[model samples]
Target: MGTGTGRKFLFVLGSARRDGNTEQLARLAAEQLGDVEQRWLWLGDVPLADYRDVRYPVSERPEPTGNEELLLDATLEATDIVIASPTYWYSVSSSTKRYLDHWSNWERVPGFVEAMAGKHLWAVTALAEEPHQAGALLDALERAAVYLKMTWRGGLVGVGNRPGDVLSDTTALTTAKTFFTA
Candidate 1:
C-alpha cells in the first residue's frame, strides 16, 4: 500500500545464494511494508563489475555499463533504501561491497548529491552467529547515508546459519515488523 507520503523502497539483496537465510529475512520484512512500491535487486543475478575510472580532461559522466546502473535509476525514485546482505568475514558480502563501490561514479552526476538529499536508508542482514556480528557492515551503511545527506532508519540483523534459521528468530521478525511502522 502507498504510505500517503509517497514513499518507495529499494531493496538491494547481496546474498549470492537463492532462498538463503538472508533472503528469507529480507522478504519477511518487506512484506510488512504492505503494497508500497518496492524494487528488489538481487545482486546474485546482476553483473556488478568493478569500477574503473578513466580520467578525462573535461568533466564527463562515467558511463555505467553494468547492473549498478539499474540500481542507480531505482534509487533516484525511491524514498527509502534497504541494503540487505549476508555477513562475510564480519563485513558485507563481496557483491554488496562491489555495489557500494559504484557510488563514486554516481557522485559525479550533476545534482546527484542534491537528489539523494533527505532520502531514508535502512539495512537488513543475516549472520551465521549472533546478530551483533553484522555491526561493521551496518556502520558502513550508516556512514554512507550520512555522507549522502540521507536519514539512517536503523537496521535489522537476524541470527541464521541455515536456510530457514532466520524464521525462528522472533526477535528479528518482531523488529522487522516495527522498523518502518515505528
Candidate 2:
C-alpha cells in the first residue's frame, strides 16, 4: 500500500464530538491514501488559546509552546494537510476557525510561510443539509490555501447530522474511496 513518495499527511480534526460524522468521513478518505504517513490531531485535545491580534502593536511574535508547538511542528512536517471539520451554520466549526487563526501567528515565524508554500490542502466536512451547504466551509479552506500558495485539492462533503449518519451517504462513501488519490 505504500505510495513510496515520502508524502506525510496531517489530518486536523476540528469536531467537538469524538468520532463524529466529519471525523468518520475523513477516516474513510484517509484509508485510501495507502501506506503514506498520516498523523491525526484533534483540536479539542490540544486546546489553543484565543489568538490575539498582535500585528496592530507590531510586537515580536513569541515562540509557540505547549500544544501550540506540537501543532506547529506537525503542520510543518506534513506535505499534505487535511482539515476535517463539521459544517456549523454553513461554515467551519469554532475550533477549526481558532486553529486557522493561529496560522497568523505561525506566519510571523521565520520561513514559516515559505515552508507552507506549495503544500497541499484538503478539506472534509459533514453537513446537516445538502452537500451544497458546505460551500462556505470549502470556500474558506480554498481561500486559505490560495493565500498560503498551497495546492487546493478540493473537498469531500458528506450529508449528515446525527452520529454515524454520514456513513449512510453513499455519494460521500464513493467519493471517499478516491478523494486523496487526486
Candidate 3:
C-alpha cells in the first residue's frame, strides 16, 4: 500500500482549453508530486471532434497507437493516476470522455484485473459556479469510479472557468490539495 518515492504516477489532463483552470491544477499537482517519480500526459490537446467513435466500432477492434497504449498499459505498472478535467457543460471534456470510453479494451489483456486490482485513482474537477448549480459532473465521475473499480480520492471544484479566476482563491487551492492528499 506504500507508493513510496520511486513509483510511477500518471496524470491524464483532460481540458480543451490550454492553461485553463483544470490544466493549471493538473500542472500544480505535477509540480507538487516532488521526486515521487511521475509523468504527466496532456491528452487535452487531442481534437475531440475526431473522436466520434469513442467506444470503437463493432466490426473491428480499436488499435491504440504506441503512445495511447502506453498510457493504458502503464496503469498496471504505475502506482497511481489522477484523472483531471474541467467540468464542461456538465461532465468531463470530450477528450477525456473518449479515453475513458476505451476502458473496456483493457479487459481483454491477460492478468489485467489482478494487475490493476487495487490501483488508486483521483478524479479532479473544476466547475464554474452558477445559479442553481449542482455537482452533476461529480455524479458522472462517481459512476465512472464505480465502474473502474478504483478508489475515488475525491475531487477539486472551483468557480473559475473564466480567465485568472482561480488564481488567487486560497480556498480552492486548499480544497484541491486536500483531496489529493486525502
**Candidate 3 C-alpha lDDT tens digits along 1-182:** 13465567777888776778776766665565656767667785433234334344543656556655776666667767777788877877878877776666655555765665566776666667651242676676666666667666666666575866766667767665645445
List the RMSD of every prediction in angstroms: 1.8, 1.2, 3.6
TM-score of each: 0.92, 0.96, 0.78
Q: What's model 1's overall lDDT?
A: 0.83
Candidate no. 3 TM-score:
0.78
> What's model 2's overall lDDT?
0.92
Q: Give the per-residue lDDT of model 1 (tens digit) for 25-82.
A: 8888888788688888888788677765543422665666557667778778888988
Between candidates 2 and 3, the lDDT winner? 2
Off by over 4 Å in 2: 1-3, 56-59
RMSD of 3: 3.6
List candidate 3 stretches off by more than 4 Å: 1-3, 44-63, 130-134
Question: Relative to the unseen true structure, what is the C-alpha lDDT of residue 116 in candidate 2, on a scale of 0 to 100?
Answer: 97
> To one decimal, what is the Cα RMSD in angstroms of model 2 from the true structure?
1.2
Residue 173, model 3: lDDT of 76
Error of 1 at 4 (Å): 3.2
**Candidate number that wins on lDDT, 1 or 3:** 1
